[model samples]
Target chain A: MKLVPLGDRVVLKQLVAEETTKSGIVLPGQSKEKPQQAEVIAVGPGGVVEGKEVKMEVKVGDQVIYSKYAGTEVKLDEDEYIIVKQNDILAVIQ
Target chain B: MKLVPLGDRVVLKQLVAEETTKSGIVLPGQSKEKPQQAEVIAVGPGGVVEGKEVKMEVKVGDQVIYSKYAGTEVKLDEDEYIIVKQNDILAVIQ
Candidate 1:
């Protein structure tokens, strides 16, 4: 089943540390700390959420750095995902 | 210094556990878990925050129940307070 997030939530697939960084440095997956990087898989519609008017800034396929302790982890069809609000995303990787 | 929260943030003074519960259960202050109830000390001027428009619902003197793990603990003038987003507040006690 496909998971569709509501409001300003964005579904992300965590990018393992082995991915290349913006500075062209390739990190090893065996790194001690988990990376905060992820690729956006789905983005909620930008609209009013919880009495606030939110605008989704990240789109699907965007690589982003999110807050470490933000979002909820969900497992869908054996695939793990992290769903967070747009405000939790810190930056977009080039 | 007086803390003036910005953009949907609320400054709250946590009510001690000794306060009475909704059903009139008088809890002892020695309870192990910290109480999640607080009194609204200051309300932010809600407006556009992180590109979202927010409206403040709670006002000063309102007793509120907030998320257990939400908000930042702050100390001002030797008095402790919790700085939380308006959304973190779950309910207002009558």
Candidate 2:
């Protein structure tokens, strides 16, 4: 399903948590923990301020680092997705 | 600890999760679940584009709604904090 964010919010499909341990030990699927990373899939037009539109700084396909404890979890078409404002994004991975 | 975000990032101190059930049954401290909410404490100056500076839209003390699964969790002087880009913020709750 196509997920669209309202206003200046963006919808992100989370990147899967790592499956292997630091030592390269692969854990079973049942025991894998969720990864705290995501990929930007959709973005809103720039936020509006006093009748002027602020352009978005990030674009689709930017890999960003975010806080692990932010954002509300939503299940869209059985796929887990996250919605956050453009301002909440920390940094784009180069 | 005072957190200064780099660039257009912000540091948020999470609000405590609710302690009472929908029926008003107060859960014990040991059994309380973490709430998916936070308060804006600090923000970065606007992001830079082409060496020009932009101003931040949100300010300190704004209650914002965010995604459940965004941001990096950090421990600052024993307090838990989340760091995310300003863009990741969803909306300001008035």
Best by lDDT: 1
Clash count for candidate 2 is: 33
Winning model by TM-score: 1
Query: What would the per-residue lDDT of candidate 2 be over residues A20-83, giving only the tens digit for each residue?
Result: 5553224455643333457897786665532346577878898875543345554433455566
Candidate 1 per-residue C-alpha lDDT over A14-52 given as tens digits, one digit per residue, 9 for 90 to 100 = 885435667543555676533488899888675777656
Model 1 lDDT, residue A73, Cα: 54
Instruction: Candidate 1: give its CA RMSD in angstroms.
Output: 11.9
Q: Model 2, range B1-94, lDDT digits (tens) per residue? A: 5888877677887764534333212223322222244688899876573354545766888766444345888898878888876656665544
When only the first chain is scored, the TM-scores of the models are: 0.77, 0.67
Model 2 regions lying over 4 Å from their true place: A1-7, A10-94, B18-35, B49-54
Against the true two-chain complex, what DockQ does each candidate achieve?
0.04, 0.06
What TM-score does candidate 2 reach?
A: 0.43
